[model samples]
Each structure stands twice: as structure tokens, then as C-alpha cells.
Target: MTSAVDVVVVGGGQAGLAAGHHLRRQGLDFVILDADAAPGGSWQHMWDSLHLFSPAEHSSLPGRLMPAQPGEAYPDAGHVVDYLADYEKRYNLSVQHGTRVDAVRRNAGQLMVEADTGTWRARAVISATGTWSRPFLPATPGREVFTGRQLHTVNYRSPADFAGQRVIVVGGGNSGAQIAADLTLDGHVNVTWVTQRPPRFLPDDIDGRALFDVATARRRALEEGRSDTGGVASLGDIVAVPPVRSARDAGLLSVRPMFTRLTADGVRWDDGSHSGADAVVWCTGFRPALAHLAPLNLRGPRGHIPTDGTRVLGEPHLHLLGYGDWTGPASATLIGVGRPAREAAHQIARQLST
Candidate 1:
């Protein structure tokens, strides 16, 4: 059985919720499908010590400001989960939890959303399925033969799991830096942090809020036919959060060049140097979680669905929200998702009216 709606939002995480807010304002009939049984989305699975790069006031959705946690400069993962749950309730958004979408394809003039629970036919589809589920692990030689434990950022929970082991943390992104710092803080594990390039740290004072501002400026410059001033990338990569800062200050967060291959017991660098390790953690980041959209055949050369803002190129009825800056300036972040969400909702509303 197919239930018809004006819009069907896939993935009820932060991005989905933001789109829901704007869609409701447009008075559109829509349903948000979420795979998670509860409201927190991926925040529920973040490592125990994870915290936002910005304060609560700066990180929020369209309708409400995230309430600040007392005495916390940066709200932790638990607070974010609580906020998302409360945000869903506060807005009364129509979210169908535990319904994982299997595929999305065109049926007649509308898009058919096939899911675990049932089906929905909608004039427009919004794919807000973020990258959390698709952790990327680089193809290092001899990785298959490695005898030690291997894990990705998605599998990380706490430093306790790797306690007393010699661990090598890979990648140079925020996750890699944070996890390396986290392990150092544990004081039980011997950590060797490696990256493909030298790790870049933002100024101690710079946070997500500033990065968002830079992204906005860079986006405006590009759209207006001006020279690209270079966005957040110009500042640096790592956010220099409190924990990372503390560990770096203590000389516990030293980084080395990435290893060229994995050995039976450990890893080997390009210079023929080797280090033994009991475990290896890959914080290499994630690709967009768009496997369900494979039937659409919309992927481009870079393995991404080409888009004009949030709207997918060549598919006017489909919008891809919250993938990253490609979807919008900073659409992947909590606060940054609002602009793109609103634009996508407005566009969908206009398309439906015609």
C-alpha cells in the first residue's frame, strides 16, 4: 500500500528535523522516516568524551536555540542528544521512527520510498541521510593480514576499550585528532598518531561558529562571481577543542607520517621504519550515506549526486539535504543546516504548488 504525501524526508536526524521545521511552515504534507528507534540520531553513538566545537547558543535548529548546559563551554554529546529529542517534541514534527528506507525510485510522476515498515509516494523526496553510517577506511597494503584489532570512528566508544594496548590512530581530521587525544588522556594506552599530511590546528579561540561564518562568506563570494576567498579550509582543519588542546599541550599528541603498509603485528612507514601495535584506529572520516539512492543512477564522476543548492541536478523532484557544503554552505553541521533546509523546503513547496 502506498500512502501519498507532498514530501517524504529520508533520515530523521538533525538535517531531517531542520527540513521538517521548514516544511511544516510551508504547510506541506510530509513524513520524516528515521532508522533510529529514538530521537538522538548519530549523536547517540558518538564517543563518550565528544563535545561540540561551538556553544549551545551557536548550535541550533531553525525554531529553537539549543539550551546551554550549566558550566559547560561546549555541550557534550549527551546534551546534544537530549536537545534533539526535545526539539522533535517541541516542534511536533511528524517523524516516523524505526522506519529505514530501502530504496527510492520514480513511480508514475512521484517518487516511491520503499522502507522496512511500508511505502510512501511523494511528489518530492528529501534525502538527509548523513555520512555517519559510512565510515571510510583507507586501503593500506597488508591491512588484510594484520593480526591486531582494527576499528573505525563509527566503532569507537571510549578509551577504556583500548586501555593497556599499543594503538596507532590514523587520519588527520578532527575525529583522528580527538580520538588520539582521548587515548592519551586515558593514560593507559601507548598511542602513535599518524596522518597522511601534517595535522593543521585552528586558533584556540576559533570554533564552529567562526568556521560557519567563513563558509558563508566564501559561498557568497563564489555565488556573486567574485574570487573565492577560501573558506574554513584556509583557517585549518582541527578545531582545537579543550581535550585536544590539553593533550597537545602535555606533549602527548605528537603526530607522525602515515604508514605505507600494515605488518602482521603493526604498521610500516615508507622509510622502512616499523612500529608494533596491538590495535589500529582509523578516523579517516565518512562518505555520504546514499546507498538507498543507487537505483536513481544520479551519481557523478566524484560519486556524489550533483546538485544546485539542495536540489539534485536533472531531478527537480528530488533534493539532497545535509550532505555537506555541496548541498549548502555548511549544511552538515547542526546550526549550518537551517539555511539549506529552508531553501529546499521552499523549493519543494513551489514545485508542489505548480
Candidate 2:
């Protein structure tokens, strides 16, 4: 099946939904293609214990506030999913769920979005596919030879799976710290954290709001051709979540330097000491899900296209939303995505109007 619209948005996650909200407001005829069976995107894949680092008010998408659950300080992954589902319904956005976009290309001045269910021919395309599908696992020597289990954050559901085992949580990000804390909860598993450098932990009072503010300031400074010397916390900084705080209080937050190499049984330290591990959980993060956009041939040496705000520099008709800070200031976060989405929609509307 083939259809045409003013815009076609790929990925119906928070970013795509934010873009949809603006596109609808701009009176653009668009369709948001989502591969998921339901409205929630990568949130559905996160571990059950995962909770937002910021409060509900700070984690909402564009226009609508995320209703905070009673008695909860921060929302869980399920709450976010429910909020996104309701947001899509509230706006009555045109979303084609369960449609996996296979590829996208330009044909005769029109963008063609090929999906499993149909093709979308649009004057412009917005790609918002977030990074959950493409989990990154570093290449370590003897990793393939390891006899124990190894999994990325995407496949990790619960710590019970690693109960009574010796586990190594690798990475110096929030996910790594949180998962490591979870594994040490029941005292059944031995958890060791390994990082190339010590993880940065924000003060107890700091949160996502402060980070967003700093990012916004930095963006504004760059736009004005000025230097920004502000030292602000980043998304990867540990937020001192309850579980993590408890773990630190119990002296479980200590981290080891990265191992020299992986051994069949475990990892070897720089001191030539080896520790046996039953499993290795790599919370090493992800790369953008840009396979569908490969045919566009817009990737630069960094594997990402240059963009002026959300608009692709080389292809004005194409826009990218919520990949990372490069696309827009703090665009990956729920709150940070709204401005970019709104700006992208406005740009798309103006471009198609001509």
C-alpha cells in the first residue's frame, strides 16, 4: 500500500509523539510510523526496576504534563508508557502502529518511506527513531571465549536472573550504577562495577531540570557565537536515586578500573589478578537506530548527519528529532525533546508551504 502526506515521521516514541503534537497544531497531514505493537517505544524494553531520574513534572513531553502517581516520588517505566499512550490518544495524532519502516529514500524530489505495511510518499520526513534497539557492547578480547553469560542493558529485565551469581556491571553511566545496585540488593549476588574512570555523581539536590537548563544555555551561547564555560551535570551522571543512595550508604558503590582484558573465566586486571565472573552485564548504552535512513546517504564521517537545529543541513526537507544533543540541546530526554519537535514541525510547515 502507498499513501502520500505532507510529512512522514518515523518512530512513535516521545520524540515522534512530540513532533506529532506540533505537526497536528501546524495543520500538517502526517503519519507517525511505529514498529511497536503499542504506543510506548523503548520504555517497554527497559528493566522493570528502572525509574526516571527526575520527577514526573520534569519528565513530561510537549504540551501535556505527565500525571504523577500518588505516593510516588518519581515515575517508573510503566507510568511513562501509559502517559505516552494517553498523549497520542489525547492529540488524536495519525499514528500507524506495528509498521516497521524498512528504509527511506528520496525519489523525484519526494521522500519515500518504505515500511512493512505500507509506503509513505511525503514532501518531508522526520526521523525520530531512538537508540534502544541498537544496544552497544564493547569489543573486548576473549569476550567470545567467555563461558558465562553476557548481555546488554536491552536484554536485562530483572536482577533475579543473576541471583547467586558473581556479576560484573561494566560502564560508567547511570544505567551501570543502577543495575549494579539492583544486583547487590538481596545479598545473593556478588556485584562488581568496572569503569574506565570514576562515575560522576550529581549532588542530591540536582536533577534533570538543572541539566536541561545548562544545555539550553550552552545552545544559546553557541548560537550567538559565544563560549560557554558552565560546568553542568550530564545525563550520564548518577542522580543519587534511592536504591543507589542506599547502596552507597552500605559501601557498595565502589568501582574498579576497567579490566585489562577479558578471560575465558572472567577478567584480568592490570595487576595480573583475575576474578571469576558468572555473568557480565554491559550497560554500555546505545547508538542511534538509523538503519532505515541509510539509503539517504546523509551520514558524515561521524556516522551522523549535520543539522541546523533539527533540520538536516544538506537536505532541508529532512529533519531529525531526539537523537542526541547534536540534533538539539538535550533532545533525547522527554522534556528536552519538545522544543526541537516544535521547531522541526514549524520548519517543515514553512518548507512545504513554498
Candidate 3:
């Protein structure tokens, strides 16, 4: 069946859902096409012990409120999934489930979305699939021989799943630190954290959005050929909560220099050292899935979709949410995507209406 809609939301997570809510309120004819069997995307697959670093008030939807029962301690990963499921029901959002989008193409007037189940055409499209769609694994020599459970943090459930096992976590991102911490303290699993740069952990009292907001202002000034964020400081220049010290003080966890190469019994590092472990978790970051959209004509050399602060660059009918922008931090957390999403929706709606 050839179905035409106002918009085809490619992702079903918070960003897509938020865009849907706005489109519905605008009374626009729209259909959200989700690749997942249900909503909550990554949150549905996150580590079970995951929680929003931001508070409940920070986790609100477009027109709804987060339940206070899971108040304040930051909603766990499971809690977030339940909230998203509930959000879908509460908004009565329209969704076509398990319809994996194979590739999206474009023609003269409209965007064509081809899925495994069917094809959908939309006047406009919002690519809300955050960078987490695929895990980024760097190429290291002898990596294929690691005779342990090597998993990306994307599929990580909990440290308990690796309890009583030796685990080595790669990458220095926030997720890597958090997962390594969990595995060591909560699950009693041995851990060896490998990363090129040491991580800086933010305190529970501070959030990435607040820091990004400050950085954004600075970026804006620089973009306009000005200096400074009009006194607003960058994340590094601004207040820092000392995440590394916080994590170590929080508990005793083992950390190591990055893995220079991989081995069968263990991994080797640049400083002529080797360690054996039972599991390897790659917490390295992600890249955009623009390869399939061969015709989109978007993206920068750094493997990022070019955008005007919040809107996609040169692509009028297309906007990418959760990409690092001057308007917000590139953290890609639920806390950051909301603003970009709302802004993108308003822009798309205004143009479509005209």
C-alpha cells in the first residue's frame, strides 16, 4: 500500500515522539514510523541500572508530565522505558511498529522512505535517530582474537550480567566510566578501563544541558565573528564538578591506559603492558548513519550532518535532532534533544504550512 503522510518520523525515541506530539497538536496529517517493536529506542536497551542524571522535572515530555513515583533519584533505564511506553499511550501517538527503515530516498518534491515492511512517502522528514544507532569500534591490531565477551555499551544490560567475570571497558566517554563503575562496585566484577584520554565526570548536582547552554552562547559569539560567550564560559572553561575524582571517591575502581592492540588471552597497551580479561565493553562514541541516504547531500567531512545551529544545513525539509549543535551540547541525552526537537518541529511546521 502506498501511503502518503505529512511527515515520516524515522525514529521512535524521545525526539521523534516529541516531534509527533507537536505535529499532532498542530493538527497536521502525520504518521510516525518507528523501526523498533516499541518506543523508548536506546532507553529500552540501556543497562538496567541506568538513570537520568537530570531530575524528574527535567525529563518531561512535550504535553505530558513524568510520574513522580520514580521521583528525584533519576529514573532508571527500565523506568525510562516504562515512561516512554506510557508516553506513547498517553499521547495516543500513531506508530507503525517493527517497520525497519531500510533506506530513505528523495525525489523532486517529496521524501521517500523504504522500509522492510512497506514504503512511506512524506512531505517532510525528521531524522531523530540519534548517533547511538550503531556502536563505533576503532580498529586495533589483533582485536579479532580477544577470547572474551566483547560487547559494545549499546547492548550492555548490567554489570550483574557479567558478575564474577573480568571485564575491560574501552573508550573514555561518560558511558564507559559509568558502566565500568557499575561493573566494579555494583556487580563485584573486575574491571579494566581503557581510554586515550582520561574522563572528567560531572557531579550529580550539575547537568550537561546547563553547561552546553553556556558553551552555546560562546559558540554563537564566535560564529558571528565575536569573541567569548558574552561572559558565558565553555564546558571546560566553566564550572566543573570533577567526575573522575567523584567516581574514585565514590568507590574503588581500576582504570588503565588505552589498549594499543588486542590479544587472545588479553589486550596489549602502548607502554609494553598486557592484561587479561573476560569481557570487553566498547564505550566509544558513534557516527551518523548517512551512508544509506546516499542522495541526501548532507554532512560534513567529520562524518556529521551539517546544520545551521539547530536546522540541517541546505536541507530545508530535513532536520537532524540530537546532533551536536551550538544550541545544545553534543551529549545526545534525553535532556539535550528536547529543545532541538521542539525548535526543529516549529521550523518544519512553519515552512510546511506556508
Candidate 4:
């Protein structure tokens, strides 16, 4: 049997929650599908030291402001999780947790979502599953022979997990930087990082179109569109971090070049080898997870649901809020998603009305 609904939202994270909020304001009948036991998605796995680089003012979602002291620091992963928990409760969003959506198919003009719990029938499907749904790990020649412990950044949370363990942090993104910094906080273990290029290392609070350009470059490269936002807009988006300078000045962690290849035991670099690590933290970042949605045949070569202006081009009822910032500035952040949410909701409402 198929359970009927006006809108079936997949993934109950920030994007799903924001989508739900907008749909509610429009008075649409909807339900959120989530595989996790709770609302927080990636934040549930983020390290203890992880915080938003975009700052509190920019990190907020729609309909609510991130509560922070004046000129205060940004919220970390846990803060984001807790905020989502509160957001759901405040708005009374309907969500089905512990429900895994295995496939989505059309049956008699209705979208049928097959999951572990049962079948869900809906007028439309909104995928709040962000690009980070799939964590990307490059396959190495001797991965099986490697004796060192290997883990993705998605599973790594807090330096306590890496305490007393020599760690090799991989990748040069902001997440990698934060993980490396936290690992060296107590000098408990020797930390070595391998990356392709030094991160541009901009100040944590810098805003404006520089951010949008960087985001668009990444989006265009990944999903074939330009993202509109501040922070992380282009290769120029990378800059020297104030913390890097302060950390170097204060004698904390050190940065290095990219990881070249993997040997039987650890990773090797073109520059040289920085050995002495029992574990490798791959902060290489995530890919969009829509393998189950393959029947739709809408994904690109990179395995993401490619879109035009964030709208899943061929699929009219399908839409993505975080797909390269189709709106103006700040649409990718927690607060920024609000504008897109409204636009997407209005679009959905229009389809329903007609």
C-alpha cells in the first residue's frame, strides 16, 4: 500500500528542515523521510572542534537568527545539530526517522517511495540530501596491504578519538585544517597532513563575492552550475588563515603540500615523506549520494543529480536547495537557504495548484 502525501521530503537535515518550514508556511501537506534516528545529519559526525568558517551572522538558516554574543565566534558542528533539533521542535515539522528510502519510482502519476518502513506516495520529492551524502575516498593500489588505521572525516569527531595516536590528516580543505589543528592541541600525537595545494587560508570571517566565486567554481565543476554566495567562490577564495599565522607564531600545527600516493603502510608525497603516523584522516570531502536514485537517470558523470539553476533539469517535481546557489548571495549557508526554500516552495505550490 502507498501512503499518500502532498510532498515527500528526503533527508531531514538543514535543507530538508528548511524545505519543510517553507512548505508549512504555504500550508502544503508533506512528510520528511530520514534514515538517521534524529534530525542532525553530517553534523552528527563532525569533529568537536569543527565550526562554521562563514561566521554566526552568515551561518543562520531562515526564520531564525543564530544566537551569539556580539561579534562572537561561529557555531561548531554540535551547535548546528542542536540548532536543527530546536528548529524542528519550534516549527512542528513532520518527520519519519529511522526510515531508509531505498527507491523512488512513479506509479500512475504518483511518486512511490519504497523504503524499509513501507511505501510512500507523494506528489513531489525534495532531496535535501546535500552533496556531502557520499564521502569520496580515492582508491589506492595497496589499500589492503596498508596496516595503518584509515578513516574518513565523516566518522572522525573530536581529538579525543585520536588522542595518543599518530595521525596523518589528508586533504587541505577547511575541514582538514580544523582536524589537524585540533589533533595538535595537546601535543599528544605527531600530526602530518598531505594535500594538493596549501589552502588559500582566508580569515575565518571574510565575506563578499569572493566567497560566491569560489563556491560557483566548485559547483560548476561538480554539478555544472555557478554558485552565488560569499566565501569559497574561487581558487582565489583560499587565503592565509589568521589562525595559521597565529598558530605558526604561537607554535602549534604546521601545514604542508598534497599527499601524492599510498604505500603499503602510509601515504607518500612528491615533496617528501612525513612518516610516523598510526592513522590517516581523509578529509578529502564528500560526493552526492543518489545511487538509489539512478533509475531516474538524472545524475552526471560524477554521480550527482545534475541541475540547471539548482532545479533538477529534466525532472520538474525534483529540486535541490544547495545545488550551487541559484539565488543571490548566502543561499548555501544555514540562513542563506531560506531564500531558495521560499522560491522552491512557491514553485512546488504552483505545480500543485495547476
Candidate 5:
């Protein structure tokens, strides 16, 4: 049996929830399809020690402020999970949990969203599925020949698993830095953290809230036809979160250049130097989770769907949210997703009305 609605949101995470909030305000009939079995989205899967770069108040969805956590300036993953669960209930959003959408395609001027449980036909579809599922591992030489265990950020849960082992952590982004810090602070594993380039740490005074402000200012400048101000990228990459700062200041977290190739038991650098390791952790980040949209054939040569604001270039009926800055300024972050989500809903409402 196929049900119909004005809009079908393919994700129940922060982006999808934000879209739902605006769609509700717009009086549009819609339902958010979440792949997860429960609320919290990707937050629940984050490593135990993971914490937001900003306070709870700065990291929130639309129509609600995330409540403060007592004695914690930066909330951990568990706190975020609880907040998301509460946000869903507080707003009474219609979510079909555990319904993973397999495909989305056009059918007689309407979009047909297919899932294991059922199908939905809608005039507009919002692809808010974030990048958590699509972890990107770089094609470093001899990776296949490496005899040691290798895992991506998605599979990592805690430092206890690597206790007493020599591990090499790759990548220079926030995840790489954080995981390295976690392992170093845990005082269990011997970690050799590597990055493609020298790790850049943001100023101690700067945090997620400040980064968001920079993104906002940059976005506003561009929309008003002003020169580019470089935005968040201008400052640095890593946020210098508490753990990272502690480890760095104590000289426990030292980074080396990326390995030239993986060996049977370890890695080799370009200078012919070598190190032995029991495991290698790749925190190389992820691509957009857009496999479900393959039927649309909208991707460009660069492997990304071109967009005019939130709307897909070739398919205006479709809108993508929370992938990255390409979708909107800082759209991938919690506080940043609201603007694009709101705009996407309003655009969809206007389109459906006509």
C-alpha cells in the first residue's frame, strides 16, 4: 500500500527534525523517515568521550534550546542523545523509526520514496540524510597489504579496545585530533598520530559558537555581494577542545607526517623510516550519505549533486540538507542546519502550492 503526503523527509536527524519543525509551521502534510531504531541520530554512536565544541545552549534545533548540563561547559555525546530524544517528543514530530529508505525516484510528477516497510508518494522530498554512514577512508598505498587491524571512525567506540597495543591514528581533522587525545589521555595504547599536513589548532578562546559566528558573517557578506572573508577556514581546523588542549599542553599528543605506505606490521614514512603498530585508525572523515538518491542521476563530475541554495540544480523538487557548506553555511553543524532547513521547507511549501 502506498501512502501520500505533501512532503517526505528522508532522515529524522537534526536536519530532518529542523525541516519537520518548519513544515509543521507551514501547515504542510509530511513525515520524517529515520533509519535509526530510535531518536538521537548519530550522536548515540559517537565515542564515549566525545563532547560538543560549544555549550548545549549554542547547539540546538529550531523552536527549542538545548537545556544546560550542570557543571559541564561542553556536553558529551550522552547529553546530546538525551537532548535529541527530548526534542523529538517536545515537538511531537511524526517520525517513522527504523524505516530505512532504499530509493527515491520520480513517478508521474510525484516522488516515490521506497523503503522496506512501505512507500510514500509526495510532491516534494527532502534528503536530509547526513554523512555519518559514509565514512571515507583514503587510498593510502599498501593499505590492503597491511597485516594489522584497520578501522574507521565509524567503528571506533572507546580506547579500552586498543589498550596496550601500538596504534597509528591517521587524518588531521577534529576526529583524528580528538581520538588521538582520547587515547593519549586514557594512558593505555601507544599512539602515533599522523596527518597529511601539519595540524592547525584554533585559538584557545575560539570555539564552536565563535566558528558559527564567523560562518554567519561570511555567508552574509557573500549574499550581499561583498568580498570573501575566508570564514571559519581562515582561523584553523581543530577546535582545541578540552581533552585535546590538555594532551597537547602536556606534550602527550605529538603528530607526525602521514605514512608513505602501510607495511605488514606497521607503516613506512617517505624518508624510509618505519614504525610497528598493531592497529591503524583512520579518521579521514566522510562523504555525503546520498546512495539512496542514485536513481535520480543528479550527481556531477565531482561526485556531488549541484545545488541552488538547498534545492538540487536539476531537480528543484528535491532539497538536500546538512551535508556541508555547499548546502548552506555550516549546514552540517547543529545550529547551522536550521536556516537551510527552514528555507527548504518554505521553498517546498511555495512549490507545492503552485
Candidate 6:
């Protein structure tokens, strides 16, 4: 059977939940379609030791605050998952779980979302499907032939999984740094960190909270016709979370330049040095999940949908939430995502109402 709504949100994570909050406040008929069987979105899949760089207060959705668990300074992945589940119930947002949207296409001036279970015909569609599902591994030569246990951050569960295994963690981002630290600190595995460029650590005081504030300022600056924030930091850089800090203090954190190529057992550096490792953990990040929207023919060669803010350039009835900085600066974060989501909801509500 086909369902219909005024708007259909394509994800149920923080982004979709944020959008749902505004859509509810706007009193619009909307339904959130979540691919996962449960409420946590991608957080549930994160490594067990993963914690937000910011405190619970800094990581929150639109209408609710993330309450910290007892004695926990920074919220862990499970905390986030529980909070997300609670957020949905607290707001009474309409969500259909396990509804993986296979494609979104224009149908008679409305967008039709084709999912695994059924179809949703809506006046407007908000594509909040974030990048977690689409992990990107750099095209390194011999990677196809490397006969080791290759895994990405998405599939990574815990350091115990790699116990006593010589592992190479690739990428300079937070995931790369954090996993490397986790493995090294546990003293169970040898981890070699690799990045294309040297990793930059934000100031000790600078956490995800500060980054959100900076992103907000930058977004506000652009909106108010200002060009710069006097030098806003790139959100892509790593934040010094507690474990990461501990790793640094213990002198366990070290990095290497990107490898020339992969070998059967390990990687080969440009200087002809070879490092043999048992497993390679790719924290190389992800591309935007725009495959469902491909039917709209909006994706560019870079696999991104060009947007004037959150709205697609030519497709006025479609808006993309979450994803990444291209949608809005730091729009993927729990705190930073609300701005674009609210904006998108407002825009869609206005369009549907009129």
C-alpha cells in the first residue's frame, strides 16, 4: 500500500529528528522514514568506546536537551542512541522504522519515495539520509588484493576485536585518531596511523561544543551578509577528546604520511619502506548518501547534490538535510544539524501551505 504525507523525512537520525521537530511545530503532516530497525541511527553502530567530543548539553536536538547519564562527562555512543530513541518518543514524531528508501523520484509534481516495505507520496521530500552508510576508502593500489581483515569505521565494533593483531588505522580524522588511540592504549595491537597530511589537533579547550558555536557564527555571518568570521576553523579537523588526550599524554599517538600503495600483508610507503600489518582499519570518511536521489538527476560528478542552502537548485520541492558541510556548515553534527533542518522544514511548510 502507498502512504501519503505533506512531507517525508528520509532519515531518523539526529538530522531527521531535528527536521521532525520543526515539522511538528509547523503542524505539517509528515512521516519520518528510518532505515534502521531501532532508533539510534548510526550511533548504535559506532565502536563501543566511542564518546562525543562534547558534553551531553552540547549534543542535543531541536526541542529537547540530551540529559547526561550519572557521572558521565561526555556522552558515549550508547548514550546518544538512547537519547535519540527518547527524543522521538518525547516529541511523538511519526516514524516508520526499517523503511529503507530505495529511491526518490518526481511523480506528478510530488516526490515519491520508494522504500523496501512500501512507497510514500509526498508533496515535499527532505533527504536527511546521512553519510554513515556510504563509507569511502581511498583508491589505493593493491587494496583489492590485500588479503587481510579490512574494515571501515562503520563496521568497527571495539578494540577487543583486534586484540594482538597488528593493525594500521588509515585517515587523519577523529575516527582514525580515536580508533588508533583506543587500540594502542589497550596495548593489545600495534596501530600505525596514516593520513594524507599531518593531523591538526584543536586546542585543549576546543571541543565539539566550541566547534558548534563557531559553525553557528559562520552560518549567521553568511546569512547577515558577512564574508568571514576572522578565521573559522575547519570542522573536518580532529577534536581532542578525553581518550585522545590520554593517548597523547601516554606518547601512544604517532602518525605517518599516506602510504604509496597497499601490499599483500601491509602497506608500502613512498620511500620504499614496507610495514606489515594483520588488519587495516579505514577511517577515511564517507561520501554523501545521494544514491536515492540519483533518479532526480541532481547529483554532480562528485556525488553531491548542488544546493542553494538546503534546497536543491532546480528541484524546488526537494530539500536535503544532514549530509555534510555542503548542506550547511557542520550540519552532520547533533548540535549543528538543527539550523538547516529547521530552515528546510520552514521552507517546505511554506511551500506546502501555499
For model 2, the stretches where C-alpha displacement exceeds 4 angstroms are: 230-236
- For model 4, the superposed segments whose C-alpha errors exceed 4 Å read 54-57, 69-72, 204-231, 235-245, 251-253, 271-274, 300-304, 324-332
The digit string of per-residue lDDT tens for model 6 on 235-349 reads 4478889899999888899899989988998889999989898999999999888788888998676655688999998799999888777898888999889888889989988
lDDT of 3 at 99: 77
Candidate 4 per-residue lDDT, tens place, 1-354, comes to: 678889988888887888899999989999998888987866777666566655565666678766663444656677778888888888999988898888887677777888889898888888776656688887755556668888888888767777788788877776676677767765776788667765666654454334644554554555444443333544343333444445545666566775566666666666775455578888887765666566677866755556655467767777766543543234555755676778788888999999
Per-residue alpha-carbon lDDT of model 2 for 159-183, expressed as tens digits? 7898789999998888998998888
lDDT for predicted candidate 4 compared with the true structure: 0.71
Note the clash tally of each candidate: 0, 0, 1, 24, 0, 0
Best by lDDT: 1
Worst 10 residues of 4 by lDDT: 229-238
Preferred candidate (lDDT higher): 2 or 4? 2
TM-score of 5: 0.99
- Candidate 2 weakest lDDT stretch, 10 residues: 228-237
TM-score, structure 3 vs. true:
0.87
Model 5 stretches astray by more than 4 angstroms: none
Better of 1 and 4 by lDDT: 1
| TM-score winner, 2 or 3 | 2
Question: Candidate 1 residues 1-354, lDDT tens each?
Answer: 779999999999999999999999999999999999999889999999999999999999998999999989999999999999999999999999999999999888889999999999999999999999998888889999999999999898898998799999998989999999999998999999999899999999999999999999999999999999889999899999999999999999999998889999999888998889999999998999999998889988978678899999967899999988889988999999999999999999998888
Ranking of all predicted structures according to lDDT, beginning with the best and ending with the worst: 1, 5, 2, 6, 4, 3
Q: Which has the better TM-score: candidate 2, or candidate 4?
A: 2
Report every candidate's CA lDDT. 0.94, 0.89, 0.70, 0.71, 0.93, 0.89
Instruction: Report lDDT (Cα) of residue 240, candidate 3.
Output: 28
lDDT of 6 at 66: 94
| TM-scores of the candidates in the order shown | 0.99, 0.97, 0.87, 0.85, 0.99, 0.96
